[model samples]
Target: MQDTRATTTVAQSGHATEVHGWLKWLEVVLVTGLFLAAGFWLRPDDPLHVGNTFAWPVLAPLLIGLRYGFFPALMSSLLVLLVAGWHYDKAAATAYPWGWAAGMLACGLLAGEFRDYWERQLRRANAVNEYSLQRLEEFTRNFYLMKVSHDRLEQQLAGSSGSLREALRRLYGELSQTRSEGLNEESAALMLRVLARYGQLQTAAILAVEGNRNIQPKALATVGDYEAVSESDPLIRYAMQERTLVSVQTEFRKHLKKLDTDLLVVIPLISSTDDLVALCVVESIPFFSFQNRTLRLMAILAGHMADMLCQRDQTMAGSHEWQSLCSQARRAARDAEAFGLPSVLLKLQVNEQDLATLADRMTGLLRGLDVIAVNRANESPSVVLLMPLTDELGLAGYLHRLELDIRENAGRSLWDFASQQSLVVKTEAQVAEWLAREGGAID
Candidate 1:
């Protein structure tokens, strides 16, 4: 909304100028007409006192010019001259009252010019004031954003531990094990739980992004005492359009105030492919936790949830780069068992030097859906392939293909590697056992 104070002041100034214009004209007409009437009544033939004495009627234009600027003063001067000329003609005077007319015109013009100069200066000052006010409003808004951000940063550093990353990893693991039904309430509720643990969110709700256009209020899953998410909320609309986290601490406070509910922030759950999965509407949060780091953590958690939800086909696209191979393998194993899809884990040990070459060549031969992870810290580096939709038979065929390709391309066969092991993941238990066999090296 526009600033009400500035708008009202501008409106009042406009009204005052209009009223002053009308009053100026009224005063000039009344004063000049009164003076002329007096001149004609008190001194019939020598109205301007041309016979000898001061010309009183000249004061009309002189005073008007000093008060009302050029136009009114010039008009008053013309009226006086008209009366004087008429009187001179009526009296059959030999010489017209040129002296009196010159004095009146000169006074009016000089005073009008002075009034015009001051009016111009006044207008310039008003313009400067308006510009300054606009700049001040902008500065205040930006300063508020900066101050809030700074306070949040201080709080985060003071109260936070260094275990956020590990906590998020564990949270992701837990989330991955749970089956996501796209935008179902179970998934939304689980996601909110994770956010609450990290963000200290007191009241919040998750609304599914329906048809990629609108947020459907029907499938909302809420926590605490949050009211239903409104379709008309300004913060919601902005967050949906921008596809980002928007909070009261940012520049969207005006929109936040317009909300009928006490909405603190609106965070979009966007997937890896930039798909809008859901909207997380936060109603209440601790003041100490409302900061930039909290925002980033929220976004990260929300994004992880979005990716998991979007992975309805068990793609595991939400896996983080920093996550250990063991985590990815565990997730793959859980998905395999849950979805009744077979997956193969192939482990190959190679010389540290040939590990890069073999992995690069293997990547070209593997399907895009396959995941490859390398453990380079070991003296005998190993490459692990998490191949989904593949079982023992699929693994056998892949080995045959790899053997032929490596022999034909590199003049060496797969048997030249140190050793290899293949496991068909049937359950999460098998994954843990497999990692144990690796002595936690894959982790």
Candidate 2:
């Protein structure tokens, strides 16, 4: 569906050629007939004489040049030279035709130059937009890929953690650690030994996204004295207020929790949506904006951790949310392709607010595409954008943006929340071919 702006351009070009198609033949006939008529009135040996006002006959080339293309411009030039022979003397009429053809050539060259410049600018802008979109999509896809793998990796590691617990407990009993006080002392001592043995950090803390009290310092890595902060501790509160790590005094054990977190990297956990999920309190210095690439890397890792945790929780807790979303997508993808007119179904998960705006933007984005229908009810909440075209890859590249804009501030994760798919296809080209293939053409 082209906008009125584009349609108007086509209409103008088409109308010009159509009008000229009629006018060109008429001009030939009228010029010839008018010359014959002139001979009857003037009645000279050369009634269509060289001195006649119409004798130059050179204006025809310019008239055709303005209305048509180079071929017509050249033909009109020759026609003028031929007609002039009846009116002009030998040397002059012959010379006039060559000069007239030269003028037509100049006009043709100018029109070609205008077309070249116009097309180059249009292609350049489109290329820039295409590169920008590809970068953004690649970043988004890698981020999600990291997340999905994280959840799967955590599940693989869970069983090994149980052996660590059992071995440590047996060591405790063998060392006369029966008293509660003795056990506490041994537990603290054992923590340091394990950190040393594994060559891990002096302090670290696990921060869960969905809850407050689930933080635990395993001291995976820390440079100096280790101490963790309680959820409501002043350091944590300050960082939360700032949305950045404040890196308060190094002697935080006196002012915070007993668990080690002194060499602290108070990393803010962020989801794919850019929302802070929970803080990954580690024993390293804080750095960079939440939007920076380094921060993105850390966030990617943390998101993967969250995904692993969520997968475990879902498996253990018997959740069906993610599975349901997947099912919806598979169904939508199969239905979206070849739907209605030859078109492309763009399955996207849009926030309720963007859904309407997308429909409007799509009209412009898909102007060159043969899009005939958009279906929202087909399992995927995002419309199945239909485009009728010869090349699906080119059309997909042309409009891949529908997904990019939604990513920057995607209201919700379509994959996480909705199962959906999109398709792009050809229109009359497809339908007519299909009908012919299935029926009369075969016979």
Predicted model with the maximum lDDT: 1
lDDT tens per residue, model 2, 221-324: 33355565566665565555665433444325346555333433455543222234455554542332222333323433343222222322222111243222
Model 2, global lDDT: 0.41
Per model, state how many residue pairs clash.
Answer: 0, 33
Instruction: Report the Cα lDDT for residue 12, model 1.
Output: 36
Q: Looking at candidate 2, what is the lDDT of residue 116?
A: 41
Task: Please list the C-alpha lDDT of all candidates, in the order they appear.
Answer: 0.72, 0.41
Candidate 1 segments exceeding 4 Å error: 1-162, 252-261, 314-443
Model 1 agreement with the true structure over 1-443: per-residue lDDT tens digits:
11112111112344433334456567889999998898779977666766657778878888877766676778899988988888778878888867778988888878877877766777788899999999999999999999999999888766552344454566666676765466676767788878887888888888888767777876467778877757778777778778788887664545444545468888888764467878889989888789887877687667657666765434322233213455556655655654455778888898988887889877878774466777654467788787766778989999889888888888987788748988898887887788666545222
TM-score of each: 0.38, 0.23
Model 2, 330: alpha-carbon shift in Å? 18
Clashing pairs in 1: none
In model 1, the Cα lDDT at residue 430 comes to 82
